[model samples]
Target: MISQYLGIIHPLFPVPSSSVKTGFTTSISAGDKLPQIQILPLLDEVLGVHRVNNRTTHQLTVPPSADDDHAQAWEAFFPEGCINPGNKVAPMGGFGFFMKGPNDFATELGKATSTHVLFNYEVLFESEWEWRKGGKLPGIFGGAGDAAYTCTGGRQSDGKCFNLRLMWRENGKGELYAYLPLTSSNTEHLLSVPPRSIQHPDYGFSVGRGAFTFVPGRWTTIAERIKLNTIGYEDGEIEVFIDGKSVILATGLILRDSTAIESRVRGLHFQTFFGGHAPEWASPKTQRAWFTNVSGAILTDERGIHRDEL
Candidate 1:
């Protein structure tokens, strides 16, 4: 068992199909076997093939092509310490995906589709990595839904979607934030519910703070259990786990406005870049970080879905 709370699914365990639906209202019992999905293995399989994109120039690639000028980019920035050598994956010893500021960015490890929708992974920051000052902070793992999920021509449609980002603030503080689009009249810039900022007269605002503090070499496990909200109701749920413990739970939220877009997890949205989006956010010097044992699973408990860390 990699983690006590989030246990690793037995490798031999059968994976479920994307179309399989779960009873959203049923309570998951101790022994109930919910449909599961594994994402870490895909990293191993696609090492030299798949590379995803963000809204930036930097993109993730494995072995460089002959015509690739960035062929030496991997060696120059991310070196051996960032990757594991053996077949077995570990938190510290497994296959590592190294990313640096300015020229390095990771969005998705696999294709973007309405399949196997849960996202899970572990992250470790290199000592030299720099934290950004402001703007949308750098993210570890997030997702972008299909066309129906996002706004088109600046108009809100009957579609639905949400994005989750593990981010850091200016003072070097780090936390996890969930971005839920509000059903507003201005579709172009639909309002977003602030993180933990929903007002409670007695409790004050709840800032969705992360469980563990950001340490340069220590590993942090992050998992997001997402279920699209029932249209027009605050039944949508987005739960996050850090290092085997449930840290932030944002429930009774709205994930969609209409039934046109089925609430299904789309892309894993593997991101590791420095800036919010611009060149000004680029690092002054080169930086690096190591990530390993990335995974995704669909468990009834949501909190128990594990991605092995060593």
Candidate 2:
């Protein structure tokens, strides 16, 4: 079966080139500061890091050597690359850190108190990077306490947790992989873009399949905005912009049913791996990807205007 949606390309929104910089607004004055976790200047350590598939080594790392190709490319774009190893990671990665409450640098930068949040970052798969089946990419996740963990890895979300991550398929086909609170009443409206918006019985929604392609060896900017719905209403929304073009726009989502603190956007979930947890998901050989300009902000409204500006 075809897994992705190859919808008609509306003339107004053209597919973007991975190599070109589109000057998209990635940071906001009112948005909370998401510390570059790769190099934590204030905090002593990240929330946690783990490897998957019985791997012994930590899958996430900063290129320890400056001469490394990943390191060189990272330095070209951001100043931190010189001192901090760009967010480099090996295959089958798992890590989670918060942007609110006591555990995050955000506490020092002021906690993120809004229901809507936006995250921005750039990613590069090395020129020789290998695509083994498919894998996960970093995105926003949140829930009431431990509820967020239930939204991923084949876990069922009981309207308490949610996760939104990007996935890359064979040859770099990309899509928004999300675990949402899908109910019988709102399922039809949530899946507005047929074919493109796929429902995975074991997982969650595979949206915008083939909406954009990740060009190996080039940098791509991803901006995602997530808005929580009114308690008990399907007014939530999610928007993904690849290289500055809107690719996935999902509205009328029901992320939560209550107004609890843990029900709001928590923070970044840095997860990447190959799989179905079988042999095929493992990388054929060692591969690397670099990340930088990791940032986030609270939005004032659904229009995506920076809250601080108001």
Candidate 3:
């Protein structure tokens, strides 16, 4: 039952003064409240924040709700966004941040000792959102802290690190994008609409592609459960629920094959951007997306104790 909650109404960090032009304002001084859970004092200081281009590109601001339904939310603005197709040097729009092991909720989640995790979040694509080719969304990541980037960037997994993120295709089509050890036995369990590989051959494949579609101008709730597989076992599981509807249920996933500390759910991988390193993936114009209610918990057994404890 241990959990952590993040809401834009209570900003995670102070909004940079230079971001005023983007409609970002300092939010109220209400701290993130975690009931029945121990709060980590170094939570804010240890986060790995990486902003694309500059801090002004992303900010926490008031949401565009019709009424007073939501107080505020985090926003990422894409201004003629693209990842530079030719040389693949410049990357525009979006922001990324990671919470690694032994920091913030990661410590409470038992670092690599725990094997299962449940995460939930809400996202809202502004009415002006233009879904070009597609983009990355938030999810979980684990492995060696220095080698965390190994799970992405077309790098193949060597039974060590792994990443699980969401992807959105044209017309708001949604799917699960993951980077992990893929084998002949586990590949057969991947489930998608019509079943196709939607990624580069070097990278990972798409799961549950188009199983549920995202709609702009409204909030979409996503809940995910990740269970790590035993060493040398292909029994890992991934279940996704979109707006309370079970859209994906896949088993026999071989996320890792070693009994190392890095082969488990480490922490949140908050990454959102547009592009496939191609010109066609660019956004047509300036647009925005909002996110709120980012939370996660380590599932426990019937006696309210982590499975490892039992």
Which model scores highest in TM-score? 3
Following a full C-alpha superposition, what root-mean-square deviation does model 2 have from the true structure? 10.1
Residue 52 error for model 2, in Å? 11
lDDT of 3 by residue, 164-261 (tens): 88889989988888787767766677733233445448757787787789999988877666788777777787766676555666777888776454
**Highest-lDDT candidate:** 3
The candidates, ranked best first by TM-score, are 3, 2, 1
Clashing pairs in 1: 90-94, 91-310, 107-270, 196-206
Backbone clash tally (model 3): 0
* lDDT of candidates 1 onward, in order: 0.37, 0.56, 0.62
| Candidate 2 per-residue lDDT over residues 1-310, each given as its tens digit | 2111123131111222121111121223111122221222212143322222233222334533333222322211111111111123323243233333224434432233466666666677767777767777778888876776567777777788889888888889888888877686446654664347777788777887888889877877787778788787777877777865667777777888864445767766655555545555656765666664454545444343322211
lDDT of 2 at 7: 31
Residue 202 displacement (Å), model 3? 2.0
**Which runs of model 1 end up more than 4 angstroms from their true locations?**
1-51, 54-117, 134-145, 148-159, 184-212, 277-280, 301-310
